[model samples]
Target: MIDQEDVAALLGTEGPFARELPNFAPRAAQQSMARAVQHAITERETLIAEAGTGTGKTFAYLVPALLSGERVIVSTGTKALQDQLYFRDLPRVRSVLDARLKMALLKGRSNYLCLYRLDQTVREGATFDRTQASQLATIRTWSARTRRGDRAELAEVPEESPLWPRVTSTPENCLGVECPFYDDCHVIKARREAQEADLVVVNHHLLFADLALKQEGFGEILPGASAFILDEAHQIPELAGQFFSQSISARQLTDLAQDSLSECNGVTGAIGLVLEPVEAMQDAVRRLRLAMDALPERGPFHQLEAKREIGDALHDLREVLAALTDVLASQAERSRGFANAHERAALISERLDRIAERDSERDVRWYELFPRGFALHATPLDLAAPLRAMREQTQAAWIYTSATLSVSSSFDHFARQLGLEDPQTLQVESPFDYAKQALCYLPSGLPDPSARDYTDRVIEAVLPVLHASHGRAFLLFTSHRALRRAAELLQERVPWPLFVQGSAPRHRLLEEFRHSGHGVLLGAASFWEGVDVAGEALSVVVIDKLPFASPDDPVLQARLEALEQSGINPFMGWQVPSAVIALKQGAGRLIRDVHDRGVLVLCDPRLTTKGYGRLFLNSLPAMPRTKELANVQAFFDDEVSAPA
Candidate 1:
């Protein structure tokens, strides 16, 4: 067994990483985290390690995990990060260590192309439009040649194309082992590889899906690993709430109706029983969405009852779905396709009934409207209990690490959120010299974030900073409204290229921004974290406000009310800590490496106006602070004139 000392030696200055990798710079922080992770693995202890930006946390964990020779599952925040770790980082680490470890990458089933669905679409000649037909043809061509069938590999097809849904399968639609293409199933292949591998890379969604399965009676998708390292672990609490929550969407209902009709194509006399009710169910869904148009985008379930039309529409939907469920139940013995459809229909009907019952004490029943559809959710008020239960059931070492895990140097809030009772915690500060490489500039004289003209004022203040930095900056906003406004105002003013979020795929926009050399990118939410642009390409990160969860959200409102009822100051106990963590994520985008120098422009007046602002400030990397715009300009000025 590899001990903590062995883990340390591999990461030390004279170790394999340092000797073999040309760009690997040894840091005491990385070694410290490696040892901690090694210790956690050896003792099978719960560890919460907060390695700040530039700590090389990836290598820190990988070394110990690869050396420990345990069946390890590494879960990241997103599919992109999962791919990065598996396809890029893991191979490098294994090669350097010469560790003979088998590793595999697994994602949610939706990511892989379902050959069954593809063939069904092909045989049915289901073509919505010319573009969709072309896209499907492209997928068919690529599907034949692709080994993994991961949709991410097909660069020719855009992620948002409607054709993807027709060709890919969800849990509700998958025929599983009964499928004709079961022998060639990509998802099963991926899982089989993961089950046999020593290490598996996955995203949090897949990890939580497995955790959620214990309750769902669907057994886990992941291998029973000896250790689970959840990198970007800060996303866990919020994500756990989502995975744990029981949600049924309009799309699911419509898909069920459509798939039921598709299943009737071959079966004799099936269409007569299924087609009319399926269409009626589809119509009910449309009526429900139309009725919901008069209400707020989302709110407590009671709001549906408050509006008589919406209530009637929802009732109509339920009756039609129940009718469809009964019909499908009659056809269940006809074919595997019928059985799957029947099961999905019955399950959704049951969920709708369960969601209808008011469970205010534990779960919050809420509904959210979309442009084309809607979703009803029943989220738990207390996520900690379920989360803790998941960890205990695994009986494996749980190591949670992220740059933004702790708030104001305290893990209490995060710990309480995830029910990490006295888990061994470690905070390794970023090895970057923040004093020399970074500056924090809090803009002065801004109205409250609630003010109607807040976005306008923020842009007015940021334009000059953009000019000073020569347009190499990320203008991150808490809301899309602010981001759009800023983009509109700067399009004509800024001389450099402007890359706005939603204008293109995130990766493409980032690539353009990086290559532009002096580009101003306006983004919201997703840009806050897991984005890396080091050196001179990015020199400034301007946050429009403190990254607080909007109180308008149904989940946040319900959570806060629950906290208030429990005698906690919801703002300080929950909101403030969460926002501080978010701000750190946004600010972290600025200084990514030791050589990277940049200015973090915090436009939120609360940082100085409120007492709790210190929490946000303290949580950030220590950097020289100033309120003067001249200071920000001077910082960049020095960057330009400094010796290379």
Candidate 2:
């Protein structure tokens, strides 16, 4: 068994990792983090671990997890990271330790191919464009030979292809044991394997879905785990809010209508009764979407109901959904499909009533519009109590680790958010010599981020630094509008190849940027973190503004109001700390590896002008601060002339 002492030795310079792996330099912070994780797992207690960049945090937790002789569920922030951990990091550690343990990777059901759905699609002979038909054909061929049925295995199909919905299953549509393909169901197989595995890798979506018992037909996987190690754990609070919230979407309504019609093909006379109500529900959904066109993209539900046309449209939708539910209920006995449709309709109707007509002090009633759809949500203002309850119910060690979990070097905000009361905590700083490896450049005399000319002036300021670094820089913005403006402004001014976020897929854009070696990449929200560009490929990172959540956001607005009602300064208590964490994530992009040398430019004048800005600066890794443009140019010059 791997004890606390063994945890340190195993990661030591002369240990198995050093002998078996290449370029395995021992990091004290990594070893310390491993020991803390091992201790937490052994005691079965909750731990909040903050492992900074270059801390080898992945290996730190993995070493202890693989050797703990316990069933572990490791949840990552995204599917990409989940894959990297399972396929890349886990194998390396398992091989080095020679630990005999079964491991499996499980994703949300949408990621897996539903054999029954595919068969139905093929039999129904649904009309499709030539491109979709070709994609369907390709999926058909791949499904036959694939073991996992994970859509990720087939690269020929784009992730956003509409055909995927037809081929994959959702909890509502999956027929469970009654499914003809139950024995060959990919999602079931994945969960079964996860149940038997000693270690399971899942993204936050799957983890929360299972915890909420939202993924029906499968036994709960989280409660059975001996330990839950949530990496990129900072995302949990927001994700937990989403999972715990009640939501109804236009897509769900459309799916229910379409699925009811699809089921009619199996039962004689079913189409006669189901078709009209289903079509009516579809039309009602369209009408609601159109009515919402006059509203903002997103706002409080009261604002939505305030408009007479929107209120009427919502009423029509509720009535049509109720009509469909009754129609499906009348036809429920004919077939299993009808029964499922009936259940889905009744549930959706109930949800629609709750979201549209109900009021709750605990929940934020909000509506958001998409291009052709909308979602009504009732998100809870307080997740702490429920999160605490879930943690206690599992009786498992909970390990939450992230580089940016703390603000101003304190975990109070994070702990309170999750209802963690005095849990064990660890903050292992980065092993990198930040003072020597990087520079923090706060550009002088910049307008407030709210100024109309802020983005323009930010571009004007960053151009010289980009030239100094020979165009290898990331200009990250807090909003899409700023990113677009910066992209347009930089196109004519910069001579380097430009890689804008929306111009290509993120992966493709990052690939092109890395290959360009001197490319200037402009991006927004998604680019703030989870991007790794080591070496000279990225030497400058310019953040256009502080990443404060917009007060205009309905959820944030509600939560802030609640805080104010309770006599807390919402801006200091909630907004500032959250923004500090976000800024840390953005600044972290500059120095990813120990050898990486770069300059981080903060164009938001608030960093120096605002009192709370000190918290953001203090939270970042200690590095030299400068306001002179010459200093940035000289830093790059020193890097270029340094020893090879």
Candidate 3:
């Protein structure tokens, strides 16, 4: 077992060996995290840690984790963090520690190219378009010399390019180890490395996929590891819910039909001409779209009652696809190529049938209508059962840490939802002087979130802070509607350049915001947590309201019904705590570093009106609070005047 004192000393060292390493400054929270990880590994106990921002928790766990001399698997909430550890931090630590440790980064199969698909596409000469044809030529040329065949190397190719599916393999389509190119497969090689490595880095989706036995090539990720570290662990519950539940979409059916037709030469064959069925499916989809489009805008589809016709059309389409599957299955013995096509068609048919069957559920089912296209999705009523099963099966030490996991010093809310029983929990406050560094302003006289003038009041209250800070702010909202309203109001009043979420990709928008110097970014949901912008660039964060899911939402309603049936109070048990965790995520974005300073402006009056408001406020970092706008301006003025 590793000694905590020795681990702390190693992390604090600033010698020649540690110069290039990301500085691991020891804060109170970092030391606490180190001790927790050490105790868990030695005692074989489960731990839930809530380390605030600026704690340097990554290095805290990494140090003791490396010293344990045990196989460790670190799972992060996002792909960006997974890449950061595998590419940047791991190498730096390995060099200084000089511990001959083997490490590998294992991503889902979608990240690698499939040689068989590439070969088939090359032989058949199915060019997507002129642009895609050129890109495919480049990929084919590069595939010969490539060792890993990782798709990330094709940087010039756009993500939405058609050639992607042609070159990559999905779980339903892959031939697995039986393929002739099995020895040369990049995915297999990566998995082989993971099985033997001392440490492995993966994301939450891949981790949960492994737990549920849904991963494509390899079975599980953590069977070899003695301990599992989950960073940004807040996302695990929702991801686990998704992996545990079953879902199928109309797009899958369309893709299957298209792929089946692509493999055939003409209108007749041993598999019969799939062209007629494909055309019929396409026609049904077009009719379904027209029926939905005919409905009034902005109302629930279920309210129309006319939606049953659309469902009937879907039923007819499923029957046609099923017939295609039967025809394809009967010819599987004739040719290997036909057999593969038939299997894909059959899976697609079954999935669509399931979707059609689920249309009657009380949960919110809606079609996402975009400029040129749309898709349908359905979420399960509750995710607790599957998540609980996953936790019970783990024999290794399980560590769940995030900057925002608890609300008001109680883990009961999130813990109960996750089915965690009596796990060790900790909530480490930020070491910064929040009273002197920031202000939490709740403007009076603002209309309720439901009122038409709410957006106007929010902008008027926040505009002064932005001007005082000289355009360094983050205007966060719970919905896109409010974001758009605020953006419009701000553009009419403020002179600084503004950045909206979808105007550019998230990474580019952040880069532009950081570099612009005069920046105000407006975003929803995703900007709440896992965002680190220290220093003067982000001096203020304005939240529109305490984020609460729409009461009419199908998933939330279903979960409520499930709870009610079991004789539980859904509000105290579900809604309130869920909102508290989400509010914590939004509020935690303020102070990223000890040197960083900012103001958090919450325009929602519910924090003062509702009895549950105190729970939300107490859950935030113990920042100084106020209702006066002048005090906020005065605080920023003082911060600006203070010596750097």
Candidate 4:
């Protein structure tokens, strides 16, 4: 085994960042984190670590992971972070360490190009607007010359444009090995590289997806990996909830019907029997869509029973799907493409039946309406058992690291959520001097967060802090409703350039904020974590309220119900702790580096008035705090005579 100190020296002041880059400072915290990671891998045990921001955590784990002789899988929370690890950070690590490790990046299948889908779309072109037509023309040019065929490489096309998904393929739409362009498949090539590399970088969604697939008795995608490291591990419980559940949407059924209509338009014999039922299925879908449109908003699946038209439509759709399945079974001599499509159809039909029948006991059924269409879903109430099974299935050293994984100085909440018991745990504090460099202002005398005027009061309260900071702040809200209200209020109040989240793409908004260097960014959930903005540009993070999951959300309700059945206090056991972790994540946005200075302004009155408020405050890093607006101004001004 490599000595931790010897390897730790490589990341010290005189090491990689110092020798290769001009402005690099090595701290003892980063070295300590790297040592912990190294020991976890070497000893073959599970470890949970909370390394605060500016610990250079990316290198803390990557340096040990690359140096360890065993193959490692580094999973991240977001694709942007994955790209950063693979493109930017890894090269810098290689510059100093002599580790000749081969690295590969594998994204979810949707990110790669499917030649068959592109060809099919072109050969059977549909009506397109001017923008869609231009976007396809650009994709066509790129397809002819690009090697990787990754969707992210198309910088010209807007991420939200509908043209991209039309050209790409989903698992249901993919023709698999029967594709004519199987020889040049980008997904297959990426997977092959992943199989051969010493280190593989993947996002958490794909990581759990592969785990879920492996449990179904498939061969492992990561066969020889001995160390499995997760960055932003706080997101695992929610993602794992999504992974462990089963779902089938109305759009999925509609897409199948449309595809069969295209395929069976000119065919004859028993195979063509699919066309009639497929058409009926399309009408049933139309009925379902119309019935849902009559409703005021989305509700649980049971609520659909009140609308007799929806149940009638489901019955019609189910009957047609059964007929379609029977016809496909009769055609035993069908081509490989037909066989694959039949398997997909049969599975989808069965799920639609289960969700429609509402035959869920341990699971929960819910529905939501989107602009495109509506989707009915059945998700498991508990994922802990499945996650524990995954740990047992893989004999690897598992290390979970994030800046905010613990609540009130305990990892019990995090561990229990994932069925992880008594794992080795470490909490490495941020090297930033929060005592001298930052201030946490929790104002008093605000209405209850549930009050109708809570958002209005919050705006009135944070205006002073924003004024003091000179518009270099992020007004992070818990919901879109609050975000809009705050953005509307702040736009008129502040003079500095204001950049709201939806005004541009996330990357563009951050860049514009940096360029303005004195702009206020109002963002919701996505900005709570995985965002890195250092220096004096972002000097404050104003959280409008405590970060807690909405009680009305289907997934959270299901989990809470399950806890109640097990005789546990869901509020104290789940809600408060979960809120604590989320609050820590939001607060972490401030004081990103040692040189950075900022104040965290939490306007929620509950932090001081409510009993559970102590838990949230205890989770934050220790900093000088105050309730007075004068002290807030002084913190920014560096005044010695400021009130304590």
Clashing pairs in 1: none
The candidates, ranked best first by lDDT, are: 2, 1, 4, 3
lDDT, candidate 1, 155-174, per-residue tens = 88898888788788888888
Candidate 3 — what's its lDDT?
0.76
Residue 431's lDDT within candidate 4 is 81
lDDT of 4 at 44: 81
Candidate 3 weakest ten by summed lDDT: 296-305
RMSD of each: 1.3, 1.4, 3.4, 2.8
TM-score of candidate 4 on Cα atoms, chains taken together: 0.94
Model 4 residue 439 lDDT score: 89
Q: Which parts of model 3 have CA positions greater than 4 angstroms off?
A: 12-22, 119-147, 152-155, 158-163, 178-180, 214-218, 221-224, 265-272, 292-306, 334-337, 354-380
Estimate the TM-score of every prediction: 0.98, 0.98, 0.90, 0.94
How would you encode candidate 3's per-residue C-alpha lDDT over 281-345 as one tens digit per residue?
A: 77776666666676433334353345688667666776787777876676666655557768877
Q: List the residue pairs that clash in candidate 4.
A: none
Please identify which of the two predictions, 2 or 3, would achieve the higher TM-score against the true structure.
Answer: 2
Quantify how close model 2 is to the true structure by its C-alpha RMSD in Å: 1.4
**Tens digit per residue, CA lDDT, model 2, 226-281:** 89999999888899999988999999999999899888887988898988988898
Q: For candidate 1, give the lDDT.
A: 0.91
